[model samples]
Target: MKSSIKDVVGEMVTPFLEENHMELVDVEYVKEGSNWFLRVYVDKEGGIDIEDCGRVSEFLSAQLDERDPIPSAYFLEVSSPGAERPLKKPRDYERAVGKHVLVTVYEPVDGLKEFEGTLTSYDETGLAVAIGQKTYRIPADKVASARLAIVF
Candidate 1:
């Protein structure tokens, strides 16, 4: 059900993003307590502002109202993914090269499931992350989740 909502929301928002020169980061449909939230994350080359979010929210809200694809009531939220944005796509990984990141794999890579460090390289095969002095080669297929990491 959540996947279906995400799919429908993605379909409804793609054109809006393209038309507005924004990139769709992600779509999440999740329940929090007794409420359901449909979150739309968007970004562009320079990042997005609140006004951008508002525009997307307005457009999406109208579309959702018209289509009524969701059976239950849900709050719609459109916003930027922020500095620690998720790295979900190949392009995202490519762009994240040389940046700090946190990557988790389904299975252990070198006996470790989580690696946090600088993303040294990314390619068709996989990505290389340098954690301190040690560099680990993590297969793309093995990755369960990845996101930019803020170095404190």
Candidate 2:
């Protein structure tokens, strides 16, 4: 149910975001306590501001109203992904090169399931992450999750 909602919202928002030169980071539909919430995370070349969020919220709200895709009541939220942004797309991985990142894999690469280091390179083959003096080659398909990490 939640997954379908997320998918519907993603389809509705993609064109709007692309038209505005913004990137859709993620869409989440979840229940916290008694209330359901729909969250949309967006970003740009630099960063997203409150105004951008408001605009997205407004646009998405209108679209949702017109489509009525959701079945129940839910609060809609739109915002930036923040510092530790998830690396979900290929462009995200490309932008993450040379940045500090935390990555998790479905299986161990070099006997490790988790990796934290400077993402040196991202290619069709895989990723090259340098942790101290050693570099680990992680298959792209093996990545379960990835996010930008703060050094401090």
Q: Measured by TM-score, how close is model 1 to the native structure?
A: 0.97
Instruction: Report residue 51 deviation for candidate 1 (angstroms).
Output: 0.4
For model 2, state the Cα shift of residue 93 in Å. Answer: 0.3
Candidate 1 achieves a global lDDT of: 0.94
Each prediction's number of clashing residue pairs: 0, 0
**Candidate 2 lDDT, tens digit per residue, 24-129?**
9999998999999999999998899999999999999999999999989999999999999999888899999999999999999999999999999998778989
Which pairs, if any, clash in model 1?
none
- Angstrom error of the Cα, residue 141, model 1: value is 1.8
- For all candidates in order, the CA lDDT equals 0.94, 0.94
Task: Please list the residue runs of candidate 2 whose C-alpha ends up more than 4 Å from where it truly belongs after superposition.
Answer: none
Off by over 4 Å in 1: none
